[model samples]
Target: MKFYKISKDSGKKIFHFNSNFIMSRVIQTDKTTNIGCMHLEEGGVIGYHQAVVPQLLLVIAGEGYVRNDKDEYFKVQSGDAVFWEKDEWHETKSDKGLTAIVIESVELNPSLFMPLKK
Candidate 1:
């Protein structure tokens, strides 16, 4: 079994992320799963982008808003969880500073589903 402790200062700032935001990668698995943390200061914004793989964002502290490609906005706070499908366009912002955990697959297509046919 493995253990991890994630703190605001745990990892390094993610490359290519918005300057107003801080992202740190906590762990990466051989199976291509990545776990990270992000910090968004007041007025910080992560511009619209699409993830190549499914992503799960769990808010651990503070408050923020997430916007989808359709321009729908959702408020999030500590203990809130958000999931984004692969290739889904989304963005995030914080008005009161926010911290969150991000988990995603590194594979191009990690999920599979089969449709039932008649």
Candidate 2:
């Protein structure tokens, strides 16, 4: 068991193009099932992208929309949780600055989300 301080996380760009605001990534990886958080400035976008592993997104602060191939989209606000299956191309557009926590854990075995490092 372990604790994580989201406030201390450093942000990086995962992808950006014609995106006015900033889309900062707090964590990104494949070594561990669980991964990062995304902090988007108002009007930010996590441009179209795909992941090899499924991801769970928990909106911590702000609102946005996630659109996919089916032309399907939905509203995402603080406390909202959404699941993105592996290989499903999607784009997250934030009308309001957004801060979201992400959990990229093995779908069948979520226990791995527990921190093993100090």
What lDDT is obtained when candidate 2 is compared to the true structure? 0.68
For every model shown, what is its TM-score relative to the native structure? 0.77, 0.69
Off by over 4 Å in 1: 1-5, 14-19, 106-118
Worst 10 residues of 1 by lDDT: 109-118
- Provide C-alpha RMSD values for all models, in order: 5.7, 6.9
- Residue 32, candidate 2: Cα error in Å is 2.2
lDDT of candidate 1 over 1-118, digit per residue (tens): 9876666576565436444677777888899898888988788777788977888788899999997788778898997877788999888889899999888975533235322222
Q: What is each predicted model's overall lDDT from 0 to 1? A: 0.78, 0.68
- On lDDT, the leading prediction is 1
TM-score of 2: 0.69
In angstroms, give how far residue 8 of model 2 lies from its true place: 8.2
Query: Could you tell me the TM-score of candidate 1?
Result: 0.77
